[model samples]
Target: MDESAIRTQLNDAGYALVQVEPRLQGLGSTIRPDVLAWAADNDGVLVPWAVVEVKHRQVAGHSAALRQLATIRDQLGTVDHYVVIDGEWFRADRGLRTATPISGPVSPANGADGVLQDVSLATSLIQERLWNAANRRRHDGQRLDSLELFADLLPGSLSGELVARSGHTVRADRDVLWRAGRRALTAFTSQDKNTDLFVSHPAIARAVAELAGDAISGTVLDPFCGTGEFLWAAADRAVAASRSVELVGVDFSSQMIEIASSLASAAPVPARAIQGNAYSELPTDVDLVLSSPPLGLRLPTQHELLNGTSTKDGDLASIDVAIRSLRSGGRAVLQISPGVTFRANGEAYRQFLAENVRVAALIGCPRGTVPGTGTGSVLLVIDKLPPTKTFVSQLGEDWEDQLSSGGAAITAAVAHLDDKTAKAT
Candidate 1:
């Protein structure tokens, strides 16, 4: 009936008590539970088991205690059983149904056997099996043929609407899927020292969208789009401007391409994603280009720049591709490595820009703004026209605040470019 007795009961039930009043990291805040325990299978593999809340007597606060235990279970990232002890009586719930009486000591047996098991444990095992099966299919160069199949394979807790409108399955939430995809890509790219998977900053992506202005229409492209951050931003800008826009994103990794496609499909504007080498294959004559391509690497042999006996760095190669893909008078916003602006090897690419495009602005991003790397970047805005006075600025420590004003600065500079071009005509 008391806390000590409950602990003794759990110990006798083959559950190892991990901690009393344990603090767990939740989605936003830390959650504290009365008791944390683990259950070991026949092979002695310990898994998270239950969270217990002990109450001295049945009172009006029992409902609140139940709710608190439920929150802790949800935050634990698994269907761990939540047990409540009210004197001699105890009940357990896995968030699937009402708490039921769990008399006597708990059992460590999981749902692997043919016998019926706890609802929560059974659901968790089923989901894990399905996930493993899906992964195996993917490894064998196959995919789930239908959403219904995926839904049927899913546990009852997640059986409804297996696939969202975005093509994201109910197997995981967007944030979970995003993190998993990123980890997979990072691991894949880690095999080659020359390869890097850089995720764009939300602040910078928003700034790029703001700088694109309200007049943007027609086709927008992100040839090296990783997870489609720029595409989402561009879609928002197009919606705000009341312009009909078509967005296209390309990435070399199939996983990244899949995430990008799902995100694009969920956007308000018309968008699509392609999985391929951005340098070798991309749509042409785009009205606008927004991208943050991988840097500090040589262009792969399959790249168009390297194919014709021209070897360039990855960043410069991406810039060249962006330039060639843009329509006449179209604009491009590129996030390039800092070396591209000052390195002697980059001078030829700079000269190419000077001769073929109008340099609008180069805004230096502060260090630590990009994810996974501390390397600074430069946002280069170029228009395919004659040269003009380029506005240059370096963001200080308060770079986010500075980037917030980027739209106004870009607007004025674009107006000046328009005025200069008109006079020249």
Candidate 2:
């Protein structure tokens, strides 16, 4: 059904319909609300609760769900009851706190434009208002914090993981963090879905972990550990699998280290974040060295003055440092940018990878893998080959497929590479 018809049916149920599109007339060019609704008392002194949006399609509805939740959160200053109404679908979602789908698709004999759906949706909305009415009366802003926002935007599996990782401690109270995370997750659905918060995306993390295996025993280091996500996740999985793992994160950005430290403090395996260059000065004798370095962004410290654009000296230096830091039979997972994987000049790094390190896998991450960062990154699992003299050049498409294969392939590669190194030594 069209938006207007849906809006009309919901309005009948005491909803103050706000058309989010076409910018809500003379209010302002910017005052565009999908739907504006209010729950009133007998006196009707603008009873402070507003439900926004009458979403139609599923995809756009999901996006609208996040945007509206954020709007509801923002509108908390003026009104308390904020909701996104999806009267056309099988559910009528309501509330500023969480994006929940109420069963609203029962078809009645006299029902038109899905009356059962509308009624069910309305009923849930009313129930939600009742639940929040007392809280609003108490003026509890914490009641409608961002958890609703996150749940609205993020996928369920990812959200569950974030909640699990947040644990007990941190600056924000448990409820407050829960709310902010939920809000961010929900908002993430609408925000750039490509940027991964790391802890939130387990599928990708699991893929990386599978390759890591028993390769990480003593210490695992992430050179460009953004917010220490990989290290915390790695330790969590390792501990679960009965592997004793020590985690360390090194990043140039102090802000990232602080953030990573906060998350680590909440996790079972506490991680250490030191502000140092990944390439030049990494901790010594690490069992695993992993990093996702910055691409194109130049650093002045290691400038060799190669070309007009300077050079990616820091990344190159870090790669060299990571290699030397690893002990024999040690492994590393380099999260390489797509440009580094395909470009001709990248042949040097690829060759360096093939010769100095065993190319166990080269997993191709889909475009949207890293949220906020628009670069496609691949997981490059490498091990230090003893005698350090196997000179292999150029990898084919088979390299991609090799990484895509599961644990068995990785195990076989690690065993074979270890055997070859032993024989050579």
Candidate 3:
């Protein structure tokens, strides 16, 4: 069997959570075991339980896999580490130079009680219902996508209302459904391949919130808010900073607006999501614009916010919506494609932006960080104040390290922006 098949087997055996290619750091470099499993602690919190490295029979031997597991053991400290060779599980020695054979099914304790594991199961179950709904409902001669189906399902499910459409009843219990729905949204995925949910990376969303500063109190807006992840993160940030902040998200998709609205209200901070075309009108009262707008897509000509802007489809057009919406001295932290950042296209608009907006900072992201997009990205931090010299840094895969209070990248970027803001003021 393949590595993925092995992971599934491990998960079935009682590992609450099983993941492949999990992002982890070893003593000095990255170490991605063939499979990683988690189990619940006393508090029902999911923690790393084991790392399984598979040495494929076709490809190689156990020595290399053993060495990698040894590194993980050294760093993670006593988390069970094992290597699978020829479909046999072997417990690795501390140094990994030696190992002993283990019994079959090396699953961790606590099968499904972990909070995250429960949530994952809930997501899977809910997703199954959504898929069934997709099979049932038809929209404009096409079935609604997974996200759209989720939006269609949430309200009725939450209200204890069931839909008897034409010939079928969507059986949903309020307690079981909405609770699962809320948790499911935390890591929701669309099974429908063609649908595009313009969501932001969680790490970048957290960074943007952190960069909003402790003094911030006015409105924070996400123009293309998908699922309200950024707003939720901002809410947490606001609570942490002890600031009274208003959060708003605008999306052209009504389904998105509905889901985002529910998500925002589900969190601690007060927030709202409105259905509006950002191209037509973005709220002008926004003090901070934190968004990851649709990349590589062109807005219709009339929606272009600035004069002399390029007609090309890229982040520049969506950024226009974000910048135009910003209040004076306001800040915008947005994701930009490399093409736009490098002036490969939209040079005219880039020039306009440079001349008019304060390009405060740029954070380069690692590959596969942004979901759905196969490419690495850059976070462009701009202010509505006068243009100034910019702060630039490349971020590692460990977002918490780079974006936290004392992290070099965030610290330097915040310092540069503050210095410029002070000078501008």
lDDT of each: 0.62, 0.49, 0.68
lDDT assessment of candidate 2: 0.49
lDDT of 1 by residue, 1-425 (tens): 66566666666665543346644434345567676655544544344556677665555345666776777767763335545556544565555345566576455565211221223333333344455656777789985532222323422323222231122223333333332333333333333333334457767877777666642689999988876777777776777678999999898876666556655654567888898887778888889989888867685463444224365578878888888888888888888898889988767667767665678778888786666676788888878777776777787787777776444555554555455454221
Number of the top-ranking candidate, with TM-score as the measure: 3
- TM-score of every model versus the real structure: 0.56, 0.48, 0.60
| lDDT of model number 1 | 0.62
Instruction: Give one digit per residue, the lDDT tens place, for model 3 in 295-406.
Output: 6776566444486544647477777878888888888888777667776566677778778888888888876556776787788888888888878787777766787668
How big is the positional error of residue 57 in model 1, measured in Å on the Cα after superposition?
5.5
TM-score of 1: 0.56
lDDT of 2 by residue, 1-425 (tens): 55565455445543442232432223445545554433333333222234345554654655556565455446433242223344533232343344545432222112111111122222233233333443564476554322232222223222222211112111222222323332333233334333343322334444455566677678989888865656755875677778777788888766566555554544455467788877567787889876767654455655332122334545444456667778887887766565655666446665556555556555566555555566556666667763442322233334434344354444454455445444322
> 18, model 2: CA deviation in Å?
29
TM-score: which is higher, 1 or 2?
1
Q: Which ten residues in a row have the lowest lDDT in candidate 1?
A: 111-120
Q: Which residue runs does candidate 2 get wrong by more than 4 Å?
A: 1-201, 301-315, 386-425
